[model samples]
Target: MKKIFTILLLSGSLLVSGCSDWLDVLPKDKQSTDMYWESSEDVEAILAQGYSRLRTCVPYIINWGELRGSSVIVPGRGTKTGLIQNFQVLPSTSTVQWGTFYQVIGMANAVLKYAPTVMDKDASYYESRMNSHLTEAYFLRGLSYLYLVRNFREVPLITEPYVDDAMPNDVAKSSETEILELIRSDVHAALATNAAKETFDGTWATKGRATKWALYALMAETCLWAEDYEECVTYADYLINATAAMRPVFMSTPGQWFNMFYPGNSNESIFEIQYDETNYAQGSGSPSKVFPYGTDVTIDSYMYSEPMTLRLIDEYTQHRGDEISRTYYGSFAGTAYANYPDNGIIWKYSGMGVADREAVRTILDANYIIYRMADVMLMKAEALIRIGGSANWTEALAIINQIRERSELNPRSEVSADNINEATEEMLLEMLLDERDMEFAAEGKRWYDLLRYGKQQNFKYKARFKAIIMENNLTAENKWLSSVLDNDNAWYLPIPAEDIFNNSLLTQNPYYE
Candidate 1:
């Protein structure tokens, strides 16, 4: 096994410089190999760099998770994003390069391999603190793989750090099942740590770092993706039950919902990538750049991506009305565009106000929340619905009603637990999906939700998913998209052509090939 000294020299050099606010403690000057890992601070600096690497993937997350879905539109006919929304993505699309995700995985692998040496070197670095840092490394690595597996379907799973240029680069792809099992294993390791306590006394660290609750959230979400309904419900219940007493994770009131984005790290936030403008900028990936905000709604030059679709806007209004809290103002802007409600701007990340757009964010440091209490609640509900029984349906309905109540919308009165027959069960499922659509619109979840819905039970709802694509796209494009999406392999992105050219073991996704 390589010693910590050499590991630091080989891997730690890549992490010495970062821009995150918490990463300020890292040494600006390069340290000698022997001097590194002498204290717990050294371990923490590596972990912080892992987090910073994760932040770089947010733009790809937003693009992969939303652009193809029926929520927001990307402008510019020849732009990469425009091609994606139109389902014309090729293997050479620049957005599909997943090197940043691998960088995050590399940082985590380094921490997991080298951080333990700090306990021996520093008297103050106890087992508990070491375990906490290790848990965070597992979280970051697992989360990055989750994103990769979801987007590319099959990807190279590299668990060890690349210590030198001589290391083999032609790693073969792992099946989705294999990748998911690794994620599960990582989650289990994270949860078993003694330092994986639920909260950091409601501080920013609680939401910013990995904790027991965050582990459970990841488990629940991954289980849902894997269609392990019982396991999903079990993990979700861990969070639901643990937070019951202290209520550490509660839904933010509608009036205060936007706070979850601007000046982020709200009570509902389980885990989010931290960003501070003065120290760390979101750069081109900033929400202001992706979904640019301006007083003039019709200026196409100002828009990098197209505005939120009117269908999404109508769904919000139908569910929550013109309430200033979440519907009209908090989630979207440009209500003054009465002639074209379809041009409503996504306001969640770039605006700060309730009931009205009070101020547009110029700093563009909004933290990209990965999981929150509301999303977890919906995951549990969807799991229960998949399990399928009157009691389970009833519980799921209650959860849905609770979320709707928080949003100041009426409880779903049409579907009842008593009459959960086949027809009503379908209705309940659509209702739950609609609630998710309304609640999480423009939050980079729409496409994944649609894909999950479509792919479940061997593409049972695939038509519904295709119809959504048709509904949101131009009539002319629908024929092409519908024909392309007929093959299930098209749903996942093509592995970038550059990666295939560089790696002998690589293979292009069948649809793209």
Candidate 2:
């Protein structure tokens, strides 16, 4: 399960280093009128920390994708063992104890509140740069809350961001419907907040940041979850029309594609987490390190190898029958990269490949990207298909083909109702998944895709996953999480018990019962 990310409601007023006052509405400790955010640097640092939280943000999506996807199910506690197995019935509150939402929410709230106050008093502080900085807080705060509403179905909508001792004894848990509505409201307000309206388009101080379009792109996604097809199309279209510079396309090789994730590579990204390996200890710690290639250590370190499947390597070509020589590489013998072995052993964990063991590492510079242009068009296409049906297939196919051509492939000439009918959603979804796979190959999309497709818990997943690992020489152990109950409880991750005892109004998820 994706760990729930909630900030602890501190009993005392916390003078924390990382988060800001925008989120912590009322720290239990009394504040000094003497201390207030005054400079752009102060505003920037506070917002930077808020932004950094997105990297380490542990929301429901991670769990939703990892545990509840279509192909896998909670085995009978046979092979894998843990709560992830019995997910469907797990209590939502179990995650509340250690969830990331509260912390983010707290920070976001603090930023939104204090940034305005900080920048408000002096007109000089309201510089164009500071305006955008203020807007960043809104974008982040709204984003943090959206993740909250999606995963748990309900949570305390804390605008003040912090939980003071005086906070109501009975904090209300908004229902999904209510929570979603609240999310939309916040999103709408974020869209309207006047930030760097004219200067945001330029990116020197503002590189790798959010604009009104970023919020719109996200709004489109949120609308899709609500099944508001029209709204989805509208918001996505707005983002696409607005951010014309961020055109996205897939690069052919893993090296080319993976390198794009290096920090500040503004190829297609509209918003991303800026990680300098040396400076930031935030986010999920570079997903690449945690993924298949990551060396395995049992709370320790040792080299472990995970290979990509022949099926995947095979899929890379797009065309089924390529020459045998070009199909494989690296350690696999008798293939292009080599020429001697039985099905090739894996080698993503190239820790042994590290040079100068004692050398200090600077920035690995990889970012977890959230929005890009290609997805905007595709999202638009999806909405078109839903709202306009086959009549709009031409537009959808056009978008898909534009992407294909970018990768040096041919575009389709026809996109008819019949063609739309013949090709299934599964096929289209595969296209989306494959695009995500290619662009974010090693960066980590496998788990999330599975969740959106509702395939993570399908029992059929294990064999499917095993087939890939065997061919790739990958290790399936760490990649897959085990569960406790055979039932859906495994699907619903355990809420850290801390939240249960504190929040009286919050009910336990059915699985917990």
Cα displacement (angstroms), candidate 2, residue 449, comes to 4.7
Span of 10 residues, lowest total lDDT, candidate 2: 323-332
Instruction: List residue ranges in candidate 2 displaced over 4 A.
Output: 1-34, 37-42, 58-98, 127-134, 194-207, 243-259, 279-284, 292-311, 319-363, 408-418, 421-494
- What is candidate 2's lDDT per residue for 391-507, written digit by digit as tens? 565567667766554444445433334577675554554555545443333332344443334422244344443332233322224234332223333333444455665667766
Against the true structure, candidate 2 reaches a TM-score of 0.68
Error in Å for residue 328 of model 2? 9.3
**Which pairs clash inside model 1?**
324-355
Relative to the unseen true structure, what is the C-alpha lDDT of residue 490 in candidate 1, on a scale of 0 to 100?
88
Model 1, total clashes: 1
Clash statistics: count for each candidate: 1, 61
By lDDT, who's the top model here?
A: 1
Off by over 4 Å in 1: 1-19, 24-35, 244-247, 279-284, 295-309, 312-324, 422-425
RMSD of each: 4.1, 7.9
